[model samples]
Target: MAAYGYFLSCEEFSPSQLLEQARMAEQAGFEALAISDHFHPWNDEQGQSAFVWSMIGALSQVTSLPVTTLVTCPTVRLHPAINAQAAATSAVLTDGRFRFGIGTGEALNEHILGDAWPEASQRMDMLEEAVQVIRELLTGEQVTHHGPHYTVQNARIYTLPEQPVPIYVSGFGPQAAALAGRIGDGFVTMTPDADLIGRFRSAGGGGKPVIGGLKVCWDTDRDRAVKTVHRLWPNEQLPGELAQVLPTPRHFEQAAELVTEEMVRKATTCGDDPDEHITAVRAYTDAGFDEVYVNQIGADQRQFFDFYRTRVLPDLPRSR
Candidate 1:
Protein backbone atom coordinates (compact mmCIF):
# COMPACT_ATOMS: atom_id res chain seq x y z
CA MET A 1 0.00 0.00 0.00
CA ALA A 2 1.32 3.41 -0.97
CA ALA A 3 0.40 6.59 0.94
CA TYR A 4 0.42 9.88 -0.99
CA GLY A 5 2.12 12.98 0.42
CA TYR A 6 2.94 16.52 -0.73
CA PHE A 7 6.48 17.84 -1.20
CA LEU A 8 7.14 21.35 0.07
CA SER A 9 10.21 22.44 -1.91
CA CYS A 10 12.12 24.91 0.24
CA GLU A 11 14.42 25.66 -2.67
CA GLU A 12 11.61 27.24 -4.69
CA PHE A 13 9.09 28.69 -2.20
CA SER A 14 9.41 31.22 0.62
CA PRO A 15 8.74 30.21 4.22
CA SER A 16 5.29 31.78 4.19
CA GLN A 17 4.38 30.10 0.91
CA LEU A 18 5.55 26.74 2.22
CA LEU A 19 3.38 27.12 5.30
CA GLU A 20 0.36 27.87 3.13
CA GLN A 21 1.10 24.82 0.96
CA ALA A 22 1.31 22.64 4.05
CA ARG A 23 -2.15 23.75 5.11
CA MET A 24 -3.53 23.31 1.60
CA ALA A 25 -2.00 19.86 1.23
CA GLU A 26 -3.84 18.61 4.31
CA GLN A 27 -7.08 20.17 3.12
CA ALA A 28 -6.58 18.35 -0.19
CA GLY A 29 -6.30 14.92 1.51
CA PHE A 30 -2.53 14.44 1.48
CA GLU A 31 -1.55 11.91 4.15
CA ALA A 32 1.86 13.38 4.98
CA LEU A 33 4.41 16.04 4.00
CA ALA A 34 8.05 16.15 2.88
CA ILE A 35 10.16 19.31 2.80
CA SER A 36 13.57 19.77 1.15
CA ASP A 37 16.58 21.06 3.11
CA HIS A 38 19.05 23.26 1.29
CA PHE A 39 21.29 26.13 2.27
CA HIS A 40 21.08 27.49 -1.27
CA PRO A 41 18.53 27.41 -4.05
CA TRP A 42 19.34 25.32 -7.12
CA ASN A 43 19.29 28.57 -9.11
CA ASP A 44 18.44 32.18 -8.41
CA GLU A 45 15.06 32.04 -10.15
CA GLN A 46 14.01 29.30 -7.75
CA GLY A 47 15.09 32.01 -5.28
CA GLN A 48 14.53 30.96 -1.66
CA SER A 49 16.16 28.83 0.98
CA ALA A 50 14.96 29.08 4.58
CA PHE A 51 16.46 27.22 7.50
CA VAL A 52 14.68 23.86 7.43
CA TRP A 53 14.61 23.47 11.22
CA SER A 54 12.91 26.84 11.74
CA MET A 55 10.36 26.04 9.05
CA ILE A 56 9.69 22.64 10.62
CA GLY A 57 8.98 24.27 13.99
CA ALA A 58 6.42 26.59 12.39
CA LEU A 59 4.88 23.75 10.39
CA SER A 60 4.12 21.83 13.57
CA GLN A 61 1.76 24.57 14.73
CA VAL A 62 -0.13 24.70 11.41
CA THR A 63 -0.47 21.18 10.06
CA SER A 64 -1.40 17.90 11.71
CA LEU A 65 0.06 15.89 8.81
CA PRO A 66 3.34 14.09 9.57
CA VAL A 67 6.45 15.86 8.24
CA THR A 68 9.76 14.55 6.97
CA THR A 69 12.83 16.31 5.63
CA LEU A 70 12.79 15.09 1.96
CA VAL A 71 16.51 14.94 2.64
CA THR A 72 18.95 16.97 4.74
CA CYS A 73 22.73 16.66 4.65
CA PRO A 74 24.18 16.12 8.12
CA THR A 75 27.70 15.27 6.90
CA VAL A 76 28.63 18.85 5.99
CA ARG A 77 27.58 22.53 6.29
CA LEU A 78 26.58 21.40 9.83
CA HIS A 79 27.72 18.74 12.21
CA PRO A 80 25.67 15.59 12.76
CA ALA A 81 25.39 16.34 16.48
CA ILE A 82 23.89 19.77 15.77
CA ASN A 83 21.45 18.24 13.27
CA ALA A 84 20.61 15.64 15.89
CA GLN A 85 19.67 18.40 18.33
CA ALA A 86 17.46 20.08 15.73
CA ALA A 87 15.84 16.78 14.80
CA ALA A 88 15.27 15.95 18.46
CA THR A 89 13.55 19.27 19.10
CA SER A 90 11.50 18.95 15.92
CA ALA A 91 10.33 15.48 16.95
CA VAL A 92 9.25 16.84 20.33
CA LEU A 93 7.35 19.73 18.75
CA THR A 94 5.64 17.50 16.22
CA ASP A 95 4.61 15.07 18.97
CA GLY A 96 6.49 12.19 17.37
CA ARG A 97 5.29 13.00 13.86
CA PHE A 98 8.72 13.84 12.44
CA ARG A 99 10.93 11.68 10.25
CA PHE A 100 14.50 12.82 9.61
CA GLY A 101 15.45 12.13 5.98
CA ILE A 102 19.11 12.58 5.11
CA GLY A 103 21.66 12.18 2.30
CA THR A 104 25.36 12.60 1.37
CA GLY A 105 24.50 15.95 -0.26
CA GLU A 106 25.85 18.09 -3.11
CA ALA A 107 28.80 20.44 -3.23
CA LEU A 108 26.54 23.36 -4.10
CA ASN A 109 25.28 23.60 -0.52
CA GLU A 110 27.96 21.70 1.42
CA HIS A 111 30.95 23.55 -0.05
CA ILE A 112 29.94 27.04 1.08
CA LEU A 113 32.14 26.79 4.23
CA GLY A 114 35.20 26.37 1.94
CA ASP A 115 35.83 22.90 3.23
CA ALA A 116 37.33 20.82 0.43
CA TRP A 117 34.49 18.66 -0.83
CA PRO A 118 35.12 14.97 -0.51
CA GLU A 119 34.44 12.70 -3.47
CA ALA A 120 31.29 10.60 -3.51
CA SER A 121 32.90 7.55 -1.89
CA GLN A 122 34.26 9.52 1.04
CA ARG A 123 31.04 11.45 1.38
CA MET A 124 29.16 8.18 1.67
CA ASP A 125 31.50 7.05 4.44
CA MET A 126 31.00 10.33 6.24
CA LEU A 127 27.24 10.01 5.90
CA GLU A 128 27.29 6.51 7.39
CA GLU A 129 29.29 7.74 10.36
CA ALA A 130 27.03 10.76 10.72
CA VAL A 131 23.96 8.55 10.81
CA GLN A 132 25.51 6.58 13.66
CA VAL A 133 26.29 9.77 15.60
CA ILE A 134 22.77 11.10 15.11
CA ARG A 135 21.17 7.82 16.15
CA GLU A 136 23.26 7.58 19.32
CA LEU A 137 22.51 11.14 20.38
CA LEU A 138 18.77 10.75 19.75
CA THR A 139 18.75 8.10 22.49
CA GLY A 140 19.11 10.95 25.02
CA GLU A 141 22.49 9.73 26.24
CA GLN A 142 25.80 11.56 26.46
CA VAL A 143 27.86 10.81 23.36
CA THR A 144 31.64 11.05 23.05
CA HIS A 145 33.06 10.18 19.67
CA HIS A 146 36.36 10.58 17.81
CA GLY A 147 35.60 9.57 14.26
CA PRO A 148 37.55 10.31 11.07
CA HIS A 149 34.94 12.74 9.81
CA TYR A 150 33.40 14.14 13.02
CA THR A 151 33.85 14.30 16.78
CA VAL A 152 31.56 14.92 19.75
CA GLN A 153 32.82 15.35 23.32
CA ASN A 154 30.20 14.66 25.97
CA ALA A 155 27.32 15.87 23.77
CA ARG A 156 23.69 15.07 24.56
CA ILE A 157 20.25 15.94 23.24
CA TYR A 158 17.81 16.39 26.13
CA THR A 159 14.54 16.90 24.27
CA LEU A 160 13.14 14.07 22.13
CA PRO A 161 9.86 12.53 21.04
CA GLU A 162 8.16 9.72 22.99
CA GLN A 163 9.11 7.42 20.13
CA PRO A 164 12.51 7.57 18.47
CA VAL A 165 12.46 9.55 15.22
CA PRO A 166 12.72 7.39 12.11
CA ILE A 167 15.78 8.18 9.96
CA TYR A 168 15.18 7.80 6.22
CA VAL A 169 18.27 7.72 4.02
CA SER A 170 18.22 9.06 0.42
CA GLY A 171 19.91 7.41 -2.55
CA PHE A 172 20.17 7.70 -6.32
CA GLY A 173 22.62 4.92 -7.09
CA PRO A 174 23.11 1.24 -6.44
CA GLN A 175 25.82 1.72 -3.83
CA ALA A 176 23.76 4.33 -2.02
CA ALA A 177 20.71 2.12 -2.20
CA ALA A 178 22.65 -0.71 -0.60
CA LEU A 179 23.92 1.56 2.14
CA ALA A 180 20.43 2.88 2.81
CA GLY A 181 19.16 -0.65 3.03
CA ARG A 182 21.85 -1.70 5.47
CA ILE A 183 21.71 1.41 7.66
CA GLY A 184 18.44 3.28 7.20
CA ASP A 185 15.11 2.92 9.00
CA GLY A 186 13.62 3.75 5.58
CA PHE A 187 14.74 4.54 2.03
CA VAL A 188 14.23 7.70 -0.03
CA THR A 189 14.59 8.18 -3.78
CA MET A 190 13.05 10.49 -6.39
CA THR A 191 12.08 8.15 -9.18
CA PRO A 192 9.59 5.30 -9.31
CA ASP A 193 12.26 2.78 -10.29
CA ALA A 194 11.41 -0.71 -9.18
CA ASP A 195 14.95 -1.92 -9.94
CA LEU A 196 16.41 0.50 -7.44
CA ILE A 197 13.87 -0.55 -4.83
CA GLY A 198 14.70 -4.19 -5.54
CA ARG A 199 18.38 -3.55 -4.86
CA PHE A 200 17.50 -1.89 -1.57
CA ARG A 201 15.30 -4.81 -0.55
CA SER A 202 17.95 -7.40 -1.40
CA ALA A 203 20.44 -5.44 0.64
CA GLY A 204 18.15 -5.59 3.73
CA GLY A 205 15.48 -2.93 3.23
CA GLY A 206 12.70 -5.43 2.47
CA GLY A 207 10.18 -4.53 5.13
CA LYS A 208 11.23 -0.90 5.51
CA PRO A 209 9.31 1.94 3.90
CA VAL A 210 10.54 3.41 0.60
CA ILE A 211 9.55 7.03 -0.09
CA GLY A 212 9.70 8.96 -3.39
CA GLY A 213 8.67 12.34 -4.87
CA LEU A 214 8.36 14.33 -8.16
CA LYS A 215 7.45 17.83 -9.38
CA VAL A 216 4.78 18.86 -11.91
CA CYS A 217 3.07 21.94 -13.25
CA TRP A 218 -0.70 22.42 -13.38
CA ASP A 219 -2.07 25.09 -15.75
CA THR A 220 -4.76 25.38 -18.39
CA ASP A 221 -2.15 26.20 -21.02
CA ARG A 222 0.32 23.34 -21.41
CA ASP A 223 2.91 25.44 -23.26
CA ARG A 224 2.91 28.06 -20.51
CA ALA A 225 3.37 25.35 -17.91
CA VAL A 226 6.30 23.95 -19.92
CA LYS A 227 7.88 27.37 -20.11
CA THR A 228 7.42 27.82 -16.36
CA VAL A 229 9.19 24.52 -15.65
CA HIS A 230 11.97 25.30 -18.14
CA ARG A 231 12.50 28.67 -16.50
CA LEU A 232 12.47 27.51 -12.91
CA TRP A 233 13.75 23.94 -12.98
CA PRO A 234 16.09 23.50 -15.93
CA ASN A 235 18.60 21.97 -13.57
CA GLU A 236 16.32 18.99 -13.16
CA GLN A 237 17.42 17.70 -16.56
CA LEU A 238 21.18 18.02 -16.11
CA PRO A 239 22.64 14.59 -16.68
CA GLY A 240 24.99 12.46 -14.56
CA GLU A 241 27.06 13.92 -11.68
CA LEU A 242 26.69 17.52 -12.81
CA ALA A 243 24.12 18.13 -10.09
CA GLN A 244 26.44 16.69 -7.44
CA VAL A 245 29.54 18.68 -8.42
CA LEU A 246 28.20 22.05 -9.50
CA PRO A 247 29.56 24.51 -6.93
CA THR A 248 27.01 27.33 -7.01
CA PRO A 249 23.69 28.48 -8.35
CA ARG A 250 25.53 30.31 -11.09
CA HIS A 251 27.23 27.10 -12.13
CA PHE A 252 23.84 25.42 -12.08
CA GLU A 253 22.37 28.20 -14.20
CA GLN A 254 25.21 27.99 -16.70
CA ALA A 255 24.99 24.22 -16.92
CA ALA A 256 21.21 24.37 -17.18
CA GLU A 257 21.47 26.16 -20.52
CA LEU A 258 21.99 22.73 -22.01
CA VAL A 259 18.57 21.61 -20.77
CA THR A 260 15.88 22.12 -23.40
CA GLU A 261 12.18 22.88 -23.06
CA GLU A 262 11.29 19.73 -24.98
CA MET A 263 13.38 17.74 -22.52
CA VAL A 264 11.35 19.20 -19.68
CA ARG A 265 8.12 18.54 -21.51
CA LYS A 266 9.03 14.87 -21.89
CA ALA A 267 10.35 14.56 -18.35
CA THR A 268 7.65 16.48 -16.50
CA THR A 269 3.87 16.27 -16.49
CA CYS A 270 2.36 19.66 -17.17
CA GLY A 271 -1.03 21.36 -17.68
CA ASP A 272 -4.35 20.85 -15.84
CA ASP A 273 -4.87 17.33 -17.05
CA PRO A 274 -5.94 15.18 -14.12
CA ASP A 275 -5.20 12.03 -16.11
CA GLU A 276 -1.56 13.07 -16.66
CA HIS A 277 -1.13 13.87 -12.98
CA ILE A 278 -2.78 10.59 -12.03
CA THR A 279 -0.46 8.64 -14.33
CA ALA A 280 2.61 10.28 -12.83
CA VAL A 281 1.54 9.26 -9.33
CA ARG A 282 0.59 5.75 -10.41
CA ALA A 283 4.14 5.22 -11.71
CA TYR A 284 5.35 5.41 -8.13
CA THR A 285 2.49 3.43 -6.62
CA ASP A 286 2.84 0.72 -9.26
CA ALA A 287 6.45 0.48 -8.24
CA GLY A 288 7.00 -0.58 -4.61
CA PHE A 289 7.20 2.79 -2.88
CA ASP A 290 5.49 2.95 0.50
CA GLU A 291 4.81 6.67 0.03
CA VAL A 292 5.02 9.16 -2.84
CA TYR A 293 5.15 12.94 -2.54
CA VAL A 294 4.34 15.40 -5.35
CA ASN A 295 5.24 19.05 -5.77
CA GLN A 296 3.63 21.67 -8.00
CA ILE A 297 6.60 23.47 -9.62
CA GLY A 298 5.44 27.07 -9.99
CA ALA A 299 2.68 29.50 -8.97
CA ASP A 300 -0.97 28.44 -9.42
CA GLN A 301 -0.64 26.11 -6.43
CA ARG A 302 -4.22 26.84 -5.32
CA GLN A 303 -5.58 25.49 -8.57
CA PHE A 304 -3.25 22.52 -8.41
CA PHE A 305 -4.55 21.63 -4.96
CA ASP A 306 -8.17 22.05 -5.98
CA PHE A 307 -7.69 19.87 -9.05
CA TYR A 308 -6.06 17.13 -7.04
CA ARG A 309 -8.53 17.38 -4.18
CA THR A 310 -11.58 17.14 -6.40
CA ARG A 311 -10.31 14.98 -9.23
CA VAL A 312 -6.86 13.38 -9.28
CA LEU A 313 -6.37 12.44 -5.62
CA PRO A 314 -9.76 10.87 -5.06
CA ASP A 315 -9.58 8.98 -8.33
CA LEU A 316 -6.23 7.38 -7.44
CA PRO A 317 -6.35 4.39 -5.12
CA ARG A 318 -5.07 5.18 -1.66
CA SER A 319 -3.50 1.76 -1.46
CA ARG A 320 -1.88 -0.08 -4.34
Candidate 2:
Protein backbone atom coordinates (compact mmCIF):
# COMPACT_ATOMS: atom_id res chain seq x y z
CA MET A 1 0.00 0.00 0.00
CA ALA A 2 1.10 3.57 -0.61
CA ALA A 3 1.54 5.86 2.38
CA TYR A 4 1.65 9.68 2.41
CA GLY A 5 4.10 11.59 4.56
CA TYR A 6 5.17 15.18 5.29
CA PHE A 7 8.70 16.48 4.79
CA LEU A 8 10.38 18.47 7.55
CA SER A 9 13.02 20.76 6.04
CA CYS A 10 15.70 21.43 8.66
CA GLU A 11 17.42 24.12 6.64
CA GLU A 12 14.29 26.25 6.47
CA PHE A 13 12.86 25.72 9.94
CA SER A 14 13.90 25.74 13.56
CA PRO A 15 13.77 22.62 15.79
CA SER A 16 10.69 23.86 17.65
CA GLN A 17 8.88 24.72 14.43
CA LEU A 18 9.66 21.22 13.13
CA LEU A 19 8.12 19.61 16.20
CA GLU A 20 5.02 21.72 15.68
CA GLN A 21 4.94 20.73 12.06
CA ALA A 22 5.15 17.06 12.99
CA ARG A 23 2.17 17.43 15.29
CA MET A 24 0.25 19.26 12.58
CA ALA A 25 1.17 16.59 10.05
CA GLU A 26 -0.34 13.83 12.18
CA GLN A 27 -3.45 15.92 12.69
CA ALA A 28 -3.77 16.48 8.95
CA GLY A 29 -3.72 12.70 8.33
CA PHE A 30 -0.13 12.30 7.16
CA GLU A 31 0.95 8.73 7.92
CA ALA A 32 4.70 9.32 8.12
CA LEU A 33 7.35 12.04 8.07
CA ALA A 34 10.70 12.67 6.34
CA ILE A 35 13.33 15.13 7.56
CA SER A 36 16.38 16.57 5.83
CA ASP A 37 19.76 16.79 7.55
CA HIS A 38 21.86 19.81 6.65
CA PHE A 39 24.83 21.67 8.09
CA HIS A 40 23.89 24.80 6.16
CA PRO A 41 20.93 26.13 4.24
CA TRP A 42 21.08 25.72 0.48
CA ASN A 43 21.42 29.51 0.43
CA ASP A 44 21.28 32.26 3.04
CA GLU A 45 17.80 33.13 1.84
CA GLN A 46 16.55 29.75 3.04
CA GLY A 47 18.16 30.55 6.44
CA GLN A 48 18.21 28.23 9.48
CA SER A 49 19.77 24.79 9.85
CA ALA A 50 19.20 22.81 13.03
CA PHE A 51 20.82 19.63 14.28
CA VAL A 52 18.61 16.88 12.83
CA TRP A 53 19.26 14.39 15.63
CA SER A 54 17.91 16.77 18.26
CA MET A 55 14.88 17.52 16.08
CA ILE A 56 14.32 13.78 15.56
CA GLY A 57 14.36 13.25 19.31
CA ALA A 58 11.72 15.94 19.65
CA LEU A 59 9.66 14.49 16.80
CA SER A 60 9.63 11.13 18.61
CA GLN A 61 8.08 12.80 21.61
CA VAL A 62 5.39 14.74 19.71
CA THR A 63 4.18 12.32 17.04
CA SER A 64 3.77 8.60 16.44
CA LEU A 65 4.19 8.71 12.67
CA PRO A 66 7.20 6.81 11.35
CA VAL A 67 10.08 9.23 10.82
CA THR A 68 12.97 8.89 8.39
CA THR A 69 15.88 11.11 7.52
CA LEU A 70 15.32 11.97 3.85
CA VAL A 71 19.10 11.49 3.55
CA THR A 72 22.03 11.95 5.94
CA CYS A 73 25.68 11.56 5.06
CA PRO A 74 27.45 9.28 7.51
CA THR A 75 30.68 9.26 5.51
CA VAL A 76 32.31 12.61 6.18
CA ARG A 77 31.03 15.17 8.70
CA LEU A 78 30.28 12.41 11.17
CA HIS A 79 31.70 8.91 11.36
CA PRO A 80 29.44 5.94 10.69
CA ALA A 81 29.95 4.73 14.25
CA ILE A 82 28.52 7.94 15.67
CA ASN A 83 25.71 7.85 13.13
CA ALA A 84 24.90 4.30 14.20
CA GLN A 85 24.67 5.37 17.82
CA ALA A 86 22.42 8.31 16.89
CA ALA A 87 20.15 6.17 14.74
CA ALA A 88 19.89 3.54 17.48
CA THR A 89 18.86 6.14 20.03
CA SER A 90 16.36 7.70 17.62
CA ALA A 91 14.77 4.28 17.04
CA VAL A 92 14.28 3.96 20.76
CA LEU A 93 12.90 7.50 21.03
CA THR A 94 10.39 6.94 18.28
CA ASP A 95 9.53 3.60 19.89
CA GLY A 96 10.81 1.72 16.81
CA ARG A 97 9.04 3.99 14.30
CA PHE A 98 12.25 5.10 12.64
CA ARG A 99 13.99 4.55 9.33
CA PHE A 100 17.52 5.75 8.62
CA GLY A 101 17.95 7.24 5.14
CA ILE A 102 21.51 7.80 3.97
CA GLY A 103 23.37 9.09 0.91
CA THR A 104 26.85 10.02 -0.38
CA GLY A 105 26.31 13.56 0.99
CA GLU A 106 26.87 17.01 -0.45
CA ALA A 107 30.03 19.06 0.02
CA LEU A 108 27.95 21.83 1.63
CA ASN A 109 27.32 19.64 4.66
CA GLU A 110 30.20 17.14 4.72
CA HIS A 111 33.16 19.48 4.17
CA ILE A 112 32.55 21.36 7.42
CA LEU A 113 35.20 19.40 9.35
CA GLY A 114 37.90 20.54 6.88
CA ASP A 115 37.79 17.15 5.17
CA ALA A 116 38.64 17.35 1.49
CA TRP A 117 35.66 16.53 -0.70
CA PRO A 118 36.39 13.42 -2.72
CA GLU A 119 35.06 12.81 -6.18
CA ALA A 120 31.49 11.47 -6.51
CA SER A 121 32.69 7.90 -7.11
CA GLN A 122 34.89 7.92 -4.00
CA ARG A 123 32.06 9.35 -1.88
CA MET A 124 29.77 6.58 -3.08
CA ASP A 125 32.34 3.98 -2.01
CA MET A 126 32.60 5.62 1.37
CA LEU A 127 28.80 5.64 1.74
CA GLU A 128 28.58 1.91 1.04
CA GLU A 129 31.26 1.16 3.64
CA ALA A 130 29.61 3.51 6.11
CA VAL A 131 26.30 1.70 5.71
CA GLN A 132 28.06 -1.60 6.37
CA VAL A 133 29.57 -0.28 9.60
CA ILE A 134 26.31 1.32 10.78
CA ARG A 135 24.31 -1.87 10.18
CA GLU A 136 26.81 -3.84 12.22
CA LEU A 137 26.67 -1.42 15.13
CA LEU A 138 22.86 -1.27 15.13
CA THR A 139 22.82 -4.96 16.12
CA GLY A 140 23.89 -4.04 19.66
CA GLU A 141 27.24 -5.76 19.39
CA GLN A 142 30.81 -4.54 19.72
CA VAL A 143 32.31 -3.61 16.33
CA THR A 144 35.92 -3.17 15.35
CA HIS A 145 36.78 -2.43 11.77
CA HIS A 146 39.10 -0.69 9.32
CA GLY A 147 37.84 0.23 5.89
CA PRO A 148 39.01 2.34 2.96
CA HIS A 149 36.87 5.28 4.11
CA TYR A 150 36.28 4.77 7.81
CA THR A 151 37.38 2.84 10.92
CA VAL A 152 35.55 1.63 14.02
CA GLN A 153 37.31 0.38 17.16
CA ASN A 154 35.41 -1.69 19.74
CA ALA A 155 32.19 0.32 19.37
CA ARG A 156 28.74 -0.94 20.36
CA ILE A 157 25.39 0.80 20.51
CA TYR A 158 23.80 0.12 23.88
CA THR A 159 20.48 1.80 23.25
CA LEU A 160 18.60 0.12 20.42
CA PRO A 161 15.03 -0.55 19.36
CA GLU A 162 13.56 -4.02 19.66
CA GLN A 163 13.61 -4.48 15.91
CA PRO A 164 16.37 -3.68 13.46
CA VAL A 165 16.30 -0.13 12.11
CA PRO A 166 15.65 -0.05 8.38
CA ILE A 167 18.29 1.88 6.43
CA TYR A 168 17.11 3.38 3.14
CA VAL A 169 19.75 4.47 0.64
CA SER A 170 19.20 7.54 -1.60
CA GLY A 171 20.44 8.01 -5.14
CA PHE A 172 19.93 10.11 -8.26
CA GLY A 173 20.92 7.57 -10.91
CA PRO A 174 21.34 3.89 -11.78
CA GLN A 175 24.79 3.37 -10.22
CA ALA A 176 23.81 4.42 -6.70
CA ALA A 177 20.39 2.80 -6.94
CA ALA A 178 22.07 -0.51 -7.75
CA LEU A 179 24.22 -0.15 -4.65
CA ALA A 180 21.09 0.61 -2.60
CA GLY A 181 19.44 -2.55 -3.86
CA ARG A 182 22.40 -4.62 -2.74
CA ILE A 183 23.11 -3.00 0.66
CA GLY A 184 20.16 -0.85 1.76
CA ASP A 185 17.07 -1.91 3.68
CA GLY A 186 15.12 0.26 1.24
CA PHE A 187 15.56 2.88 -1.51
CA VAL A 188 15.04 6.65 -1.46
CA THR A 189 14.92 9.11 -4.35
CA MET A 190 13.70 12.64 -4.96
CA THR A 191 11.85 12.10 -8.22
CA PRO A 192 8.77 10.07 -8.97
CA ASP A 193 10.55 8.31 -11.80
CA ALA A 194 9.10 4.91 -12.65
CA ASP A 195 12.17 3.82 -14.59
CA LEU A 196 14.43 4.38 -11.60
CA ILE A 197 12.12 2.38 -9.38
CA GLY A 198 12.05 -0.40 -11.98
CA ARG A 199 15.84 -0.35 -12.16
CA PHE A 200 16.12 -0.57 -8.38
CA ARG A 201 13.85 -3.61 -8.18
CA SER A 202 15.59 -5.32 -11.07
CA ALA A 203 18.94 -4.68 -9.39
CA GLY A 204 17.93 -6.87 -6.44
CA GLY A 205 15.82 -4.41 -4.49
CA GLY A 206 13.04 -6.98 -4.77
CA GLY A 207 10.16 -6.04 -2.45
CA LYS A 208 11.85 -3.37 -0.33
CA PRO A 209 10.09 -0.05 0.05
CA VAL A 210 10.89 2.81 -2.36
CA ILE A 211 10.35 6.35 -1.04
CA GLY A 212 9.96 9.58 -3.04
CA GLY A 213 9.67 13.27 -2.08
CA LEU A 214 8.84 16.58 -3.78
CA LYS A 215 7.86 20.16 -2.89
CA VAL A 216 4.63 22.03 -3.53
CA CYS A 217 3.37 25.51 -2.71
CA TRP A 218 -0.34 25.98 -1.91
CA ASP A 219 -1.70 29.51 -2.15
CA THR A 220 -4.58 31.33 -3.76
CA ASP A 221 -2.14 33.27 -5.91
CA ARG A 222 -0.12 31.02 -8.21
CA ASP A 223 2.14 33.90 -9.21
CA ARG A 224 3.00 34.64 -5.58
CA ALA A 225 3.75 30.99 -4.94
CA VAL A 226 6.07 30.91 -7.92
CA LYS A 227 7.97 33.92 -6.66
CA THR A 228 8.22 32.33 -3.20
CA VAL A 229 9.71 29.14 -4.59
CA HIS A 230 11.93 31.17 -6.90
CA ARG A 231 13.28 33.06 -3.91
CA LEU A 232 13.56 30.17 -1.44
CA TRP A 233 14.37 27.02 -3.40
CA PRO A 234 15.90 27.87 -6.76
CA ASN A 235 18.52 25.40 -5.60
CA GLU A 236 15.99 22.68 -6.37
CA GLN A 237 16.15 23.41 -10.07
CA LEU A 238 19.96 23.16 -10.41
CA PRO A 239 21.14 20.71 -13.03
CA GLY A 240 23.70 17.92 -12.97
CA GLU A 241 25.98 17.59 -9.90
CA LEU A 242 25.73 21.14 -8.56
CA ALA A 243 23.70 20.07 -5.52
CA GLN A 244 26.30 17.48 -4.55
CA VAL A 245 29.42 19.58 -5.07
CA LEU A 246 28.47 23.09 -3.96
CA PRO A 247 30.58 23.75 -0.86
CA THR A 248 28.78 26.67 0.74
CA PRO A 249 25.42 28.40 1.01
CA ARG A 250 26.89 31.42 -0.69
CA HIS A 251 28.01 29.25 -3.58
CA PHE A 252 24.50 27.88 -3.86
CA GLU A 253 23.09 31.39 -3.79
CA GLN A 254 25.38 32.36 -6.66
CA ALA A 255 24.35 29.30 -8.63
CA ALA A 256 20.67 29.74 -7.87
CA GLU A 257 20.69 33.22 -9.37
CA LEU A 258 20.48 31.46 -12.71
CA VAL A 259 17.15 29.83 -11.79
CA THR A 260 14.23 31.67 -13.31
CA GLU A 261 10.66 31.95 -12.03
CA GLU A 262 9.49 29.88 -14.96
CA MET A 263 11.72 27.02 -13.89
CA VAL A 264 10.24 26.99 -10.40
CA ARG A 265 6.73 27.02 -11.82
CA LYS A 266 7.64 24.19 -14.17
CA ALA A 267 9.24 22.08 -11.46
CA THR A 268 6.92 22.49 -8.47
CA THR A 269 3.15 22.43 -8.23
CA CYS A 270 2.09 25.81 -6.92
CA GLY A 271 -1.23 27.44 -5.94
CA ASP A 272 -4.51 26.47 -4.26
CA ASP A 273 -6.12 24.30 -6.89
CA PRO A 274 -6.81 20.89 -5.36
CA ASP A 275 -6.46 19.19 -8.71
CA GLU A 276 -2.90 20.44 -9.19
CA HIS A 277 -1.83 19.24 -5.75
CA ILE A 278 -3.51 15.88 -6.36
CA THR A 279 -1.67 15.42 -9.65
CA ALA A 280 1.69 16.25 -8.07
CA VAL A 281 1.27 13.55 -5.40
CA ARG A 282 -0.24 10.94 -7.74
CA ALA A 283 2.89 10.98 -9.89
CA TYR A 284 4.76 9.18 -7.12
CA THR A 285 2.01 6.63 -6.53
CA ASP A 286 1.85 5.92 -10.24
CA ALA A 287 5.61 5.48 -10.25
CA GLY A 288 5.29 2.58 -7.76
CA PHE A 289 6.61 4.44 -4.78
CA ASP A 290 5.69 2.75 -1.49
CA GLU A 291 5.90 6.02 0.41
CA VAL A 292 5.76 9.68 -0.71
CA TYR A 293 6.54 12.81 1.26
CA VAL A 294 5.41 16.32 0.32
CA ASN A 295 7.12 19.51 1.43
CA GLN A 296 5.39 22.91 1.60
CA ILE A 297 7.99 25.31 0.19
CA GLY A 298 6.78 28.58 1.70
CA ALA A 299 5.22 30.15 4.78
CA ASP A 300 1.73 28.89 4.06
CA GLN A 301 2.22 25.60 5.87
CA ARG A 302 -1.06 25.73 7.77
CA GLN A 303 -2.85 26.67 4.58
CA PHE A 304 -1.19 23.80 2.73
CA PHE A 305 -2.10 21.28 5.43
CA ASP A 306 -5.67 22.54 5.47
CA PHE A 307 -5.84 22.27 1.72
CA TYR A 308 -4.62 18.69 1.88
CA ARG A 309 -6.94 17.70 4.69
CA THR A 310 -10.14 19.28 3.47
CA ARG A 311 -9.67 18.86 -0.27
CA VAL A 312 -6.60 17.10 -1.65
CA LEU A 313 -5.99 14.10 0.62
CA PRO A 314 -9.54 12.82 0.53
CA ASP A 315 -9.71 12.89 -3.27
CA LEU A 316 -6.43 11.07 -3.95
CA PRO A 317 -6.76 7.57 -5.43
CA ARG A 318 -6.71 5.31 -2.39
CA SER A 319 -5.73 2.09 -4.12
CA ARG A 320 -2.69 3.27 -6.04
Best by lDDT: 1
lDDT of 2: 0.91
Lowest lDDT 10-residue stretch of candidate 1? 311-320
* Candidate 1 clash pair list: none
RMSD of each: 0.9, 1.1
Encode model 1's per-residue lDDT on 126-226: one tens digit a residue.
99999999999999999999999999999988887889899999999999999999999999999899999999999999899999899999999999999
Q: How does residue 262 of candidate 2 score in lDDT?
A: 94
Backbone clashes in model 2: 0
Which prediction has the highest TM-score against the true structure?
1
Off by over 4 Å in 2: none
Go through the candidates in order and give each one's C-alpha lDDT.
0.94, 0.91
